[model samples]
Target: MRLAIIGGLAAGPAAAAEAKRRAPDAEVVLFEQGPHISVGTCEIPYLLGGHLEPETTLQVLTPEAMERTRGVTVHVRHRVTALDPRRSRLTVEALDYGSTREEAFDRFILATGARARRLGVEGEDAAGVFTVRDLVDTHAIQRWLDTQPVRHVVIVGGGYIGLEMAEAMRSRGLRASILDPNGRVLGSTVACEASDLMDRAVAEAGVPVRAERATEILAEDDGRVRAVRTDRGELIGCQMVIVSVGVEPRTELAAAAGLRLGDMGGVAVDDQMHTSARSVWACGDVVQIPRAPDGRRVLWPLATMARRTARVAARNAAGSASTRSADRFRPFAGAVGVRAFGVEVGSVGLSLSRALDAGFDAVATDVRHVSRTRAFPEAAPIDVRLVSERGSGRILGGQLVGREGAALRANVLVPLVIGGGTVRDLAEDFDLIYNPPLGPAVDPLKVAASQAMRDAG
Candidate 1:
């Protein structure tokens, strides 16, 4: 089998490695347009904060290591310009030398990933404005920091990237402010109470946040960002601006090849990660897969989801008989975590608003507990919230907020929600580990589950 994978950042490399492992004799080739492959994009914020070294972030998987150890052909600085699904061929270009060639493959995986969404405001082309997407963007920001006197930074979004960058700027002794179009921070993913907590945390870290949209980016005569004008006619001055509005799937290549797209604006793929075109599969941020809670197709764009879908796509491409079975490939339940302003937050499955929107009578309960026993002097407060179906008590989702152990606690609910466990089952049957230094005997998860059960009743 000739397996060709496009876009080697996260999923493409995984697909190539997995395909080679499954079928040793198969020819697996991976192509990445950028100079680097398998970058840890999630750690980019830490690079700005000086917590993580730049060299460490670029060491995910070198092309030479991928080829030598994994037995996969790794081609960096090579872009796949066109894909002809009917002919099972790809037109590639060598970026450095301006050379083009055609490669035929028996199977192909598209892991094209996503690009950062632009603000599209006036003066967006100004010099001091940047979008955090890849290593190049990171280098650009670092160069600006070194060359310019950037004392204050204005972030134009309230999502994870915006929040993380705010924290990073604070660590660098710069004034960081976030301007969000949404009324609340993390409003789309977290509940109002949790969002309120995060707002307070950011405020405590000396980062000013405003719930207003940026109307335009005003630039000086030198074409550098000077100030940002808001909808309320306020101009906030800043030396630099970071836009983290979100990301959109890079699926122009797939669309040009006549591949079907989902309602979420991603390449449509089935549970087995097979695209609409035969002999081709799509994974990573470029594809929309089923959300396990409601079985609705949604764009997760998470690293964990990317790797899982890539493995499934690779096994299928390798013609593994066991992988062809329906039961082996499970749908993805969205799980995500973020740390900002010394607070760790995590969420799994759906928020209460999302559950209600999915046509379920959902009720939620929030419980506050000490992470450790009261006798422990280092005990910190942990807040947990659980949402469940009103009548059936079926667990739907959960959120956790704390200085520590918040992400791990939220992760425990993922399996329960995926396995269709009820709130009562978690309250009565779940045996969570207990240690005085780590957590109390009565786990916070159980407390949230028990409260959710009562709220539902």
Candidate 2:
């Protein structure tokens, strides 16, 4: 059996390795358009900040190593232009060869992730504006930083990538300014409260944020970006600009092949990662997945979901009886954990506003406490807002903001909600580990849960 997988970053490589494990005799091959395969996209920010070195950014597993160790072939810089499902073949263009080739496969997996979004503005194609999605983009920006006297940077977007790049550019001694059309910093991803927290952090760090604004990149004499003009009648002076508005799944190949696309603008797949087409599967950021709290298909671009879905695709492709585990098929565990400015802020599940929108009577309780023991040294005030169903006391969602050990508690709320545990469950039966050097004797989660249950009654 011959199996072919496209886009050998996280999902493609995972499916290949799992297929190799399931069917040792099967011939499996994966293709990646980039120079390196199986690189961690989430570590890009740390790499830019010098927290992680670029030399160690790409996880280099040579094709020879994969072939010898796992019986898989990894072809780098091989771009699949088209897929013929009827013939079970892919039209691949190898950039190094300057030629196209057709490869046959008995089974195929489409994990061709997403591309960075671009602005349609007149001068957006100028030399200094770039996106920071892939390693190549990161390298390009880093190389430019090394050569240019970049004193100011204009980031057009307030999403995760844009905010991280702002911090990274600031660390590089550049005056970083963000221009977001949305009223809040994180916009749709985070609630207004969390957005305000980020705004405060950015302000304290001396980073400039122009909210409710759009940009028009203006070019200088050499067709290079000189400044960014906003729709709100303001011009931000900067030579370098980074735009990370958002991403759309690269599903053109799959859509052309008669596969289903989801409302979330990604490929549609079943719980087992099988697409509508026979013997074809999809995963990663390309697939629209079930959202938590409700079962709506949402495209959550976290790495964890991609890996789990890849295992399902690999199992089916290898003719194994294995199915996607229940844990993998569920909605996003609903956690966006972030820490900045000597403070931690996190949100999980649905916010009170979201729960109300979803036709649930949501009640929220705001609790404040010292992160450490009251008398302990370096204690910081912690604030938690616990949201629950008004009648049932079921823990629906939560938000945590404080200094020290606070962001992690938001992670704890996700599993509780995912497992269908209620506020009563947390209030009465939650077991917490405690250490004077780490956690308080009464865990903040339990404290919040108790308050939630009391309010529910």
Candidate 3:
């Protein structure tokens, strides 16, 4: 069997390796359009802040290592221009040599992932404007910082990337400001109270965050960005602009090949990661999977989801009998984690608003407590909010915010939500490791769950 995988960032490599492992004699080939493969894109902000070296982001896996260890042919700077499902052939372009070739495969996997969404406003093509997406973009940002006199940066979004880059710019002694069109930071994902807390944390770091949208980008004679014009008619001066609005799935190849797409504009795949086309599979950010909380098919561009879905696709491609079972694939619960300033935040399943929107009679309960025992000198404040169905007390969702132990605590709630455990079940059956220096005797999660149960009652 011969397998051809497109897009070698996160899912493509995983699929290639897994396919090789499951079927040792099968020929596996991974193609990447960039010079590097498997870049840790989440760490780009830290590289910009000087906290991490540029080489660290490229350390996830090298193409040579994949070839040497996994017996997979890794082709960097090779772009798949067209897919011929009927012929089982791909029209690929060798970017470095400017050559074109055709590759035949018994099976194909589409892991093209996503590209950064752009604002179509005027002057967006200015020299100093950037979108944080790939290794090339990070290198370009680093070059700008090294060559140009950039003392201030304007981030045009209030999402996770925008907030993280704001913190990164501040660490590098640059004045960072966030301009979000939405009235609140983090938009509707986070509750109002938690959003306010995050906003205050960013503000305290000397990064001014505005709830105004950018009408236009102002550029100088050299076509370098100078400032941003807001919808409120205010000009915010800056030397650089980082646009982090969001990302859209890169499904041009899939759509052109006539693959069915989901409501979320991603390639539609079944539980086995099988696309509508025969002998082809799709995974990563380009495919929409079932979100567990409400069973809705949504686009979740998380690394965890990407890796899991890719492995499933690989197993099916390799003709694994276990993968043939309908129950082999697990649903994604949309688990996520983020850190800004000194606070770490995490959420799993749904938010309070999402639970209500899903037609559940939900009640959210918030609890505040110290991460450690009060007697412990290093104890820090931790806040937990749990959303539960009113009558059944089922744990629909949860959010955590704190200087420490936030993500760890939120991870505990993920299984509960996936298993459909109730708040009362968490209160009665949950066991958390504890010590004076680590955490309180009664876990904060249990406390929050108990409170949720009461609210449900």
Query: Compared with the true structure, what per-residue lDDT tens digits does model 3 show for residues 14-48?
Result: 99999899889999999999888798888889889
lDDT, model 3, position 404: 86
* Candidate 2 root-mean-square deviation in Å: 2.2
Look at candidate 1 and give me any clashing residue pairs: none
| Model 2 quality (TM-score) | 0.93
Give Cα-based local distance difference scores for all models. Answer: 0.86, 0.79, 0.87
Tens-digit lDDT track for model 1 on 295-387? 888888778888888988888877755656552357666778888877888888888889989998988898888788879998878888888
RMSD of each: 1.6, 2.2, 1.6
**Candidate 2 C-alpha lDDT tens digits along 339-418:** 54455777888888887887888898887766767667887767788888887888878888777777787788888778
Model with the higher TM-score, candidate 2 or 3: 3
Q: Per-residue error at 352 for model 2, in Å? A: 2.9
- Every model's TM-score: 0.96, 0.93, 0.97
